[model samples]
Target: MRAPLKLYLAGPDVFLPNAAAQAEAKCRLCAEFGMTGIAPFNPDLDMARPAAQLWQEIYADDLRMMRESDAILANLTPFRGASADAGTLVELGWFLGQGKPVFGYSNSAVSFAARSRAQPDDALPGTAIEDFGLADNLMIEGSLTLPLTLPPDGQCRPFDSLEIFQLCLEGIAGWGQGFNR
Candidate 1:
């Protein structure tokens, strides 16, 4: 039998208090969808090191995992700021650079412009908010093969919502890519 597709699961969930739990849940979902989910973090990394060293090790490990994956499934929900997590974007870019298919989902139903405050008197003045009426930056939006979004009336979803993530899986399955279970 053929091997299942390996997807680099990119998102801001790694910084959450329940990072491991979220990863496990995502992996389980991926299995149900007949794919292998490769989350960015490696719990086996040695944490007993200097801050810089540990960070460097993490970066290297994440790159290695990304290289081993077939494609990326990114969570493009708004993070600490008004945009998706910067690190997740980097991972997506890495895959894109390699000409790998990229998929993503946003728990929010709101458009990027609607969520952004770009009026002249806006508290976050000066820089112009990307008002393209997209779920995220135009570049990211255009990169996705399937950018699943929540229902139009969906409320503010937490960073870890899996509703749209599952939608992404379904989209992949329906793509007729001949994945192996």
Candidate 2:
């Protein structure tokens, strides 16, 4: 039997309880589609450390998963409209850097550019306005697009989570096939 496609799922953890729940749900769904899901939100992982250290650990953990996994599924939803969780972003980048396929969903009303616009212009001299607008992965804007199919780098999709999952599953299946070739 073929090994199940291992998916390294990435997302924000500021909403620890909720984020963790969502991660598990996604994992189960991936399994339904014949994929194994791995997430950083697992209880065994040490995520309560200092920011710097936490990031280092997260990078290491995600890198290992991406190296072994078939693809990635990321929740691009902005936590409190700030942006997709920072650590999740890092994980996404790591997977993309490895040329792994990525699929992400954003249920956020505010775009990354909008968040920067919301900040007071004088808030910081060198503040880099981070835009959660686009990433290397597939942006699932399922509900946000409604009957219309928006381009990959378009607006946010309020109801596109399911579509995102389907797309990611397909992408992962295809990616995994490449590995067997």
lDDT per residue (tens digit) for residues 58-90 in model 1: 999999999999889998888876678899999
- Give lDDT tens digits, candidate 2, residues 90-114: 6666676777666665554455576
Clashes of each: 0, 5
Looking at candidate 2, what is the lDDT of residue 111?
A: 51
| Candidate 2 wrong stretches, greater than 4 Å | 18-20, 45-59, 80-82, 124-181
- Cα-based lDDT at residue 174, candidate 1: 80
TM-score for each model: 0.89, 0.61
Task: Report, for every candidate in turn, its global Cα lDDT versus the true structure.
Answer: 0.83, 0.60
Q: Give the CA lDDT, 0 to 100, for residue 19 in model 1.
A: 94
Candidate with the greatest lDDT versus the true structure: 1
